[model samples]
Target: MEQMNYSFSVCSSELDYDAYLAFLLENYAHIRLPYPFPVTLSFLASPLLMGEAAFLICNEDNQVIGAFSYIRGTGERQYEDRHIVQIQVACIAEEHRCTRLFLYALQYFTQYLAHGEEQVQEFRFFAPSDDSLRRLFSKISSLTASLETDSGPLDEYRASFSEWQSYASQFRQTALFNS
Candidate 1:
């Protein structure tokens, strides 16, 4: 199957940040979250004040489509070998989602950290309303990991090279590896 091509850029400017947060609030029901959709500026401003990288995804037409906020944590802060790269907000524009724009932003983020950190061994999505979000994640083969929801298991797919390598070795026994 051919991957749909999309032109996108990652940004962190104030305008992009605000736009990204708005997109999240508009689409929060679809993405699934634990709490009521957050107030945009306050949600982002508090995190920005703490000094973490905020990422925005834009499409070919230069409209902001998605946003993901992540924070790095060392071994066993929560789970085994799973370094916490908390995904605070993640949403793809309703029209451009199938273009895999959110994945593009995630890919850029992984590479962006490669030069410094260990490139994030694993990522966790601990949403309050993950049930609504699992369907979209189920489409990506790499995103198979899940946590238990009231319904069943919520997806928690791999978004890092190391986790991919480990999964490949333990399960597929395929030589394919990242990094």
Candidate 2:
């Protein structure tokens, strides 16, 4: 199969915020409570306002197909001592779920972190303790056992830059062959 090309852009006022918000609502609004409300434009734009970045993934025609956001945490707490980039959310359009678009978005995001100004020491996120998610993330780094938090039971995953590079390389090879 040929590689499916996708483009990524940081959400900015210059782009169509309304369309982006609509796309997010269409794809992710089903996620309820304790999860940050994603149905509103304000909520979707909050990450950009908070000095973090939100990226929109688009296909050849520039249609919004997926998105993700990350924020650098202030190392005030014990668990946050390292320079961490917490992946706030990652959502793909239903039709694009099993496609390489998801992996492409992740690859782009990881490359951004590896080469960007943040110099992130660790990447972190809370995900359900499920086989698929674990398999996907484990490609990049080792994960901690599921731990209970105020929100709910979520497994915490963290990866250093070196670890990410290793995974990125492997992902690239897999993508290359699969393409």
By TM-score, who's the top model here?
2
**CA lDDT scores, all candidates in order:** 0.53, 0.67
Writing each residue's lDDT as its tens digit, candidate 2 over 1-179 gives 76676788777764655656667778765332134454234446656667678888888889998877776774367435437877766778777676366656666776777667557778787676677778988877678767765655668788886777665566553332111
Please state the error at residue 8 of candidate 1 in Å: 4.2
Give TM-scores for every candidate, taking all chains together and pairing residue i with residue i: 0.59, 0.75
Pull out the clashing pairs in model 1. Answer: 33-129, 34-128, 145-156, 147-154
Candidate that would win on lDDT: 2
User: What clash pairs does model 2 have?
Assistant: 1-179
Off by over 4 Å in 1: 1-10, 38-47, 74-83, 117-119, 128-161, 164-179
